[model samples]
Target: MAGDEDMKEGGLDWAAAYRRLDRLAAATDAAATTDPEQEREVMDERARRLARTVSARATPGHLLELVHFHAGEQDYALETRFVREVLRSSEQRVTLPGAPEQLRGVVLLHGEVLAVVELSPLFGRPAPTHHGPVLVVGQGRAELGLRADRVEEVLSVSRDALLPPPPALGAQERTLVAGLTREGIIVLEGEALLRDGRLFFDLSEERVS
Candidate 1:
């Protein structure tokens, strides 16, 4: 019985020793497979990790303003703050017989006549009816009305969110888009729309004899 007990203890000790040797052999094989190229790859991965950590801690500087709107099937946004008021669909008086093809007609707002332009037509899309709300935009020395399907909402976005304009935009669209945002492209040049003769009636200049 004593001999049998000693043999059992010896077997247990051998099993533990075999497990330790197996673990050591696996570790040795892994170390042997790590060549110079693998070591460089590991170092490069560590450098990239450090770079990302440092960049995340850096400070960002700049702010952006965003104005949201909708055009046709797509939604859009502008950065200009010239928007004064948003008016629902109103009666427009088609008085001008000769006007630009894009010009829909004229509308009276608060005792003043304002030319209403279809925003979709300017973007190379099918023109929308002047039956919707008029986005009243106040430019440097003029107030113009822009007809839109729906005036969604206005929001202020940061500069980091503004993206560069795509190269596919037409000349007119290029002139209108200031920057791209998550909401849409910001119409930085909306004032130019007011400058168009078809969309504005200059009241500042009078006939001089």
Candidate 2:
């Protein structure tokens, strides 16, 4: 039930906490010193060490590596293997007139016209008007530029910490969601997402308005 503030208040810094028993050993070495102040210091240090040890051991372990970013109001992540590169989405993109609304347009990247997909709609959220950056995902012809509201940081997630999508999610959003992270990040099934959407196939042949 304790929060981060509680841990900080108790001096539960990991490194210091893990070294709790070490101070006990040090106290033994200084056993010959009869100075009351020195003895009191050692006892206080021992208490701090005990607190840290309890805190560290109680913390659960759940870690997975992912490239995280923001889209709409939610946070999302893709495994590093599926990430090709990340570029600014502010650069003008050539809009595909007849493509699905999810397909924002195509952006030129490294001399290649990369099809950009707006994930907000696919996740059942309203499309964001302001673009942040292009998260280049997948590889080869399956590569895509995903429009992110903001690119956060690469995270290490714990498999056990992932939660199932809420039952209230629409089928489309559920299909794209791998699971919800303990920290609330949406872990996406990158390969399944791209395969299911098939964003690039027949993109050159725009639909007639």
Candidate 3:
């Protein structure tokens, strides 16, 4: 059929993928299983399926993968390539003296102190006294965690779909945002974020001395 041919031109059999997702959904037990681990796995699978759906909406070769997340009351996204991992925030966070106000604290990540950034103030909101999960991102020495109130899921969008930041955003806010999607996700400029010197602190000095 023409639909199959259309999907072929895009390089993905999106229809087949959607049908398989439907089967998975139908097989899920409505009763809700008691196993936390199993439930987490199921949710993750659903997220993956949703990402595929978004990718299908975008043109095949032009798709840009993003990790969609919630920060404060707003929605945001970062290119998947910059994000190394998502870590659960810990209450044991240690604050360092003389760091920028945006620096929330440091979290123990894989036997190292990973600096955490709080962007709420940049958007005219009061900083959260308690940090949320950390989005591990950046390049080399700049790699650190960006606090998020909640991580929704990973997604994909067409390059053409990213529209310019709306006029409602303040000057500072405009500088941080690369584009906004129809879904209301403000896509931050990953390279600009990585190059921001404020995000980096010489942690190597604190390392074995």
Separate clash counts for every candidate: 4, 4, 0
TM-score of 1: 0.56
Q: Could you tell me the lDDT of residue 49 within candidate 2? A: 42
Task: Tally clashes: model 3.
Answer: 0
> lDDT tens string, model 1, 26-74?
5545764777677677567657744643343312235544346675655
Best of the two (2, 3) by lDDT: 3
TM-score of each: 0.56, 0.62, 0.62
Lowest summed lDDT window (length 10), candidate 1: 1-10
Shift in Å, residue 49, candidate 2: 42
Model 2 clashing residue pairs (backbone) = 62-158, 63-157, 63-158, 64-157
Predictions in order: lDDT? 0.53, 0.64, 0.67
Distance from true location, Cα of 45 in model 3, Å: 16
Q: For candidate 3, what is the lDDT? A: 0.67
- Model 2, 79-175: lDDT tens digits are 7656765665454454433346676656555445567788777666787766678877764443788888888887777777789987888886788
What pairs collide in candidate 3?
Answer: none
